[model samples]
Target chain A: MSNPVSERGFEPARHAELALLLEVAGTPKPGNVDRRRDLSGLCFEHFLTGAVGSAAGLRLAEDGAPVGEAFETAVAGMSKQGGGNTQFGCLLLLVPLVKAAVAGDLSPEGATRAAEATTVDDAVSFYRAFEHVDVAVGDPPGDASDLDVRRGSEAESALRAEGLTLSDIMELSAERDANAREWTGGFARTFRAAESILNDEGPVTDRVARAFIDLLTEEPDTLVVTNHGEDVARDVMDRAASVSDLDEAETLAEEFVAEGINPGTTADIVCAATFVALERGVPL
Target chain B: MSNPVSERGFEPARHAELALLLEVAGTPKPGNVDRRRDLSGLCFEHFLTGAVGSAAGLRLAEDGAPVGEAFETAVAGMSKQGGGNTQFGCLLLLVPLVKAAVAGDLSPEGATRAAEATTVDDAVSFYRAFEHVDVAVGDPPGDASDLDVRRGSEAESALRAEGLTLSDIMELSAERDANAREWTGGFARTFRAAESILNDEGPVTDRVARAFIDLLTEEPDTLVVTNHGEDVARDVMDRAASVSDLDEAETLAEEFVAEGINPGTTADIVCAATFVALERGVPL
Candidate 1:
């Protein structure tokens, strides 16, 4: 695999940022904040600020800082620049992926190793990160106790009592959270998307759009499910699957914006996929 | 003025990169390669790569390194990511601007102080930077000898014999090169553009687009003149002056792109203006 840092002349943070940028800039990303649409009071510029501001923390992860802490720091910095929840899910996905790339491997195994290395401090930091921004997520399961994100430091204490690692917590939430699913499963779908994106031809944006649509079709977006409901998420997945052309995708995007459906989690996954491909020197 | 580094959470390099981004992303930058057009075998992606890759060197300039070496280093890194001269002019303007911003004033006077503080080695470094990219420029005047950029090191030697600083060389070329004019005259027009951009209320990209058109209309683009002819450059200026809105600007952009008439120098100025606005926390 090509070393994006030395060969491509961009640091891991820059790679993360470029990935975020390309992901958001990919037009006609149906039901997502893209070039043609802004939803949830978030525009393209907020994402731009978030991505660039987050790069510093992502770089720190290479020095063996807790990835979750780095993710929290990145989110905090992003909010300080533009106080919004834009790219929060993308930031969650990218931090670990960047650490994995900086760990000197671009494979799923490498990503898993990076995720596995997270400690209790990372879990604490992960809980603390919630204090910085209002990231949209589904309610904790009815059966679960002491896992509420809104509990903040209290959740951290409970997580400590249970002695569960950040990765363990992610495993518990994987059923409902696409972002958590990637974390617990070592980003299997992200790696697959990277492969598809790398092998596909045409502009980088087009390839990312294709990968995004494919990812959306493969799974109903968790963000849509969280914000709206499972039915809406399922309907969105079907609509994404129906996008056979750019024109149709744009039409779908308009409809998604009109209906207030944002497939933010899938967009987050696509950002991770983009990071993987870029670390391997995907042509933009 | 807002502190971009502290308050905005973006480093000087990121600010430089953002300036390059907003400048290039500004749509309907008539006769220049904006988001909607490509020119001279260069596309928007190449510019994106260059801007991000160039960030490190821009950061170096903030650390009191010679501005010329920073420019060369930035261009060299840019070529590694995307082999082209997509934003050479913008990079030239940004390096000094970044250094000035890092000097703690973030104003035109501060910019001038940084430029004036440059050394003879900086002049040599500036000459060396030209070897990395094929930047569009007019030939030296009839009286100048051994000053041709194609001479590379020989030009540096001649510059040394004359005991001329980088600013001195810029002063000599200021008449024909808009980028040199910024270097020689403390970026007067750029500061003015920044004032206008600051007072204007809209998206940063839109403000940049309007600034670009205004700048192009106010001065005959040196790149257009160098690539085409004075008559053609004048005609382009006339057409740019006729743009009353973004829609009209978009139409003119298409016509200019089709004619291969690029107002690259004006775009470079817009990048400087963007730097000034962003360093002051212009909402984009």
Candidate 2:
């Protein structure tokens, strides 16, 4: 927990948990389950539970375990805590980032290399990760074979028969999933957001809220699209883009919450961005 | 960290940090640094830093190190993070409790035995803990020799000459310092709060906030007394006692913040209570 004095080097697990906690504690994060508000089924405490639940397994990625195994373990631990997917996308983004950090490289290039190295076993474990909670992923591309997420082990078998690595599956879903796009496209937006967060002119929470707004504005949240529709998601992004004041954002937040238009994917990206900022030793 | 699979047992360090985070994240925690507000000199980020800074030493106490040594190390680490005393009283309460938990004892009697086991070295180290932060404490009893906290090492030397254990020093300050009172009185209120938290039928944050208000109502907050005087402290207590509604509490919180009446001692007790609850397998 303290700075390592021995050969063990930096602890990525602590950094990951701290980043997740910071992201959740960031107030006025519109449409997300932030410190200021908690939705009925998905309370802020669930995220806290998920953060603690994931810590040990995320640390295991540093020990050369497959990222997918860590992801599955973390997801299982989180499910045991409660009956919801409070941070599924955040976990997905963090697993590889944690592995890359353990390898002493945390840049987009580093994350890309880590994601590119995923194996079939990692793909199988990734499928296993979906068994516990109802993670919101869009329908697979029409060309994909037997890619239904609910068919957990069956999907793993199909993925294995197709000789698809986890990275390959991510590439397939990249067109729809922002998290997958981050994985396949070398986390470009996440890295940029990280840079901005490091240089932001405020408290860590304020910086995180700003970063979240920026991310939300830049992309239509896939979760919103899945739950609502493309038009609604695009409208959310547009509203996010127009916000220059936090108070205005807060007003919009109430509207979004009432309409059930959570920009959850963007919140996930902010969590990753926070991880990068923290890993780079931002004073926050 | 994960639960014990072999001989290592549960991790107290993670629980401690989680408790601290939950305490800070609990919204509208009147006159304290909760998610909705940050004091001018002490921002929320400083508390975050202090939590991270204190983790390693608290873990060391769980490894059977002397509570005083852990307290000094934690305070020194926190001082290095910034020039503030974020959780000094909580640390004073937690070090002994963590030690007791490591011994498989976390009740009031257990904490009492643990505190009663302190040595003069522990007393000296406790004095040294003061060197790092300007924690709030009242003037010493007129009869006690060389007992000033501002004297630092000189006071430590005087304490050594007097052959006082850390618990003996705590006993001397118990009348004025609520945290010291907890140590001397075997953490009775903390243990009671823990029981309340365990039996409470809601989210952990809600329980914590309720427990905090209850504590504030019962005790006139020695920290507030030190800053504003006894009448103001009693008035604050009566106001806290009248809060049957959280929204009303929030309004009062604004007034308390404007008046600069921080109930820090109650916050410390809440932290200890949180530790006890977590240790006893509270769902949080």
Residue B25, model 1: lDDT of 75
Clashing pairs in 1: none
Assess chain B of each prediction and give its TM-score. Answer: 0.94, 0.94
Off by over 4 Å in 2: A1-11, A142-147, A153-156, B1-11, B76-83, B141-147, B151-160
Least accurate stretch of 10 residues (summed lDDT) in model 1 chain A? A1-10
Clashing pairs in 2: none
lDDT of 1: 0.80
Question: A133-168 in candidate 1: lDDT tens per residue?
Answer: 777877898876578877666787788888878888
For each candidate, give its TM-score against the true structure.
Answer: 0.94, 0.90
- Model 1 DockQ reads 0.33
Q: Lowest lDDT 10-mer window, candidate 2 chain B?
A: B1-10
Error of 1 at B78 (Å): 2.2
Instruction: List the candidate 1 regions with Cα displacement exceeding 4 Å.
Output: A1-9, A143-145, B1-9, B143-145
Model 1 C-alpha lDDT per residue in residues B147-225, reported as the tens digit of each score: 8765666687788888988888888888889888888887999999998899887677788899988998888899988
Which candidate tops DockQ?
A: 1
Please give the distance, in angstroms, between residue A22's alpha carbon in candidate 1 and its true position after superposition.
1.5
For candidate 2, write residues A180-257 as lDDT tens digits. Answer: 999999999899999989999777778898899988889899888888889999999889888997778888778888
